[model samples]
Target chain A: MIEEGAGQVDGTIRAVLRDVLGLTQDRVNAFDESTPLFGLLPELDSMAVAGVLTELEDRLGITIEDDEVDGEMLETFGKLAHFLRKKALL
Target chain B: MLRFGPQDGPVVIAAPALFEEANRTRAFLVRILRLLGVHGIAGALPDLPGQGESLLPTHQATLAGWRDAFATAARHVSAVATVSIRGGALVDGPAPVSALWRLSPITGAEQVKELWRIRQAAHDRPKLRYDPARFIAELDVEVAGNRLAPGLLAAMNIAEPSSDAPVRTVRLDTNPRPADLKLPGRPLWRASEPDVDEPLAQALADDIAAWVHACVA
Candidate 1:
């Protein structure tokens, strides 16, 4: 069983954004839950998008369905964090 | 645990190149081993460090790193025969495919370089960014190939047949299976798109199957 903590999940997302996709923490953390990742980050191309999602799935130990993802959910850092927290349970 | 059969002879593993090819050939490669039957066991291919199913957080893997992974997997498998699709360069040795592309190069490597080049230059008159072109040009000057990192060059160079460890090849197609496989003139290779008359696609699936069987047989 995985441990609890929305904060921990936030840390995981931040790490993947920084290391795998090579984004600065300042760049990622600046936006709230409504920021659009695909629109904002030039690096967030299809490969990087898939890669970041894959990294999250691995760390969280849960598979994310394609249908579950909508453009609106990942609009901001906070929303992405919230979505991940929910996904971790799923 | 999907245990491969006959703890003797050699092990055959399918190693394809990146992106679309890997996704396209994965299932067909697996089927090839199944067809091989008692010849060899095409060992399971897990995702690379940063790609496919084995994604891990805080990990960014390079091609050389992937070579090490392949080496590790090869060592772990217990068999007299081992097979890999486009993995010959890593297993055998690095050789450039620049010459092959001299006439008509449509391999993924070329496409990647092209896309990256466009992105680097911001699509300005199809010229890559000054830094990358200069960087790649310098690297190209060092190697026999042109405009590529040494590591990438090595990865692209698979035309060189494997002689380092006695790996075998069994190129297959309709009406003409590999001479060694000794299958009937009309082999049972599945054709996903016969209507398109794409021999390469049909042969790829069939050849992979034959390669797997050869390893077991």
Candidate 2:
């Protein structure tokens, strides 16, 4: 089971990206804190973002409001993990 | 092909979501169910208003209009049970539908996102353009090669199985992970190419038929 921590969250996020977007395991694992998402990753486009968010919601059991989404929250892999962890807390 | 089984027998309405899934699984599923001794009617639900040789244009379509069409489809064959697949599960349940069988059901948000993704892939866009939430807010986005009106998006957003309904889910796991250890069966949906997965369809047919039989019994 994935434990509650930054490490776990990052790994889970990576897994989701790999599974949902059909990204290679190596490619997803290569994503780190500095790696930009959204505008940066070609696979992490608008529609891909929706799929990612839906998977996140299902796996984490958290409700993400429409207004809450912006460039900042999804800027990087680390940022996405931190955002999800924060939601998990709430 | 809607009516099946003995004369005046129970009819199962096959309500599959529009677009690629409908293109892929509708006919295959219907045929499998018939062989399994289940009366199945595959609904040819139009994704857009003016679609499927209809006279009305898509721009004029509303959420209620789509619901009316589904209700009409269900009425044509007098559906006693509902077998909703993929995004079709998001449609409002037809009246008198006692049992709801969903196969790999997806949310309205997923549908919207998928439409955009398919569009993006089609165009080979360099980056993501449409934000799903904001796109929906615009209330007039193109989806699955058709127009997505405001009302229709609202309906899709709210389309979910009710508490009172007896809903069962058959998740086809294509990429199994440790988290999906509980659900049996390999992911046959994506195992092969060309959209039609006969083995997966057969498994779903058997599962749905058994469930329908038990429900009626």
Best model number under lDDT: 2
Off by over 4 Å in 2: A1-8, A25-30, A66-68, B1-11, B18-56, B90-92, B95-98, B104-165, B169-203
| Most accurate candidate by DockQ | 2
Superposed Cα deviation of residue B161, candidate 1 (Å) = 6.1
Please give, for residues B6-73, the per-residue lDDT of candidate 1 as tens digits: 45534544344443334434555455445444443334454555445655421244456665665566
lDDT of 1 by residue, A1-90 (tens): 345677678777876676455556797666556666866767765445544664566456666654466566666687788889887754
How much DockQ does model 2 earn?
A: 0.08
DockQ of every candidate: 0.01, 0.08
Interface CA RMSD of each prediction in angstroms: 17.8, 7.1
Q: Candidate 2 local accuracy as lDDT?
A: 0.61
- Chain A TM-scores, candidates in order: 0.80, 0.87
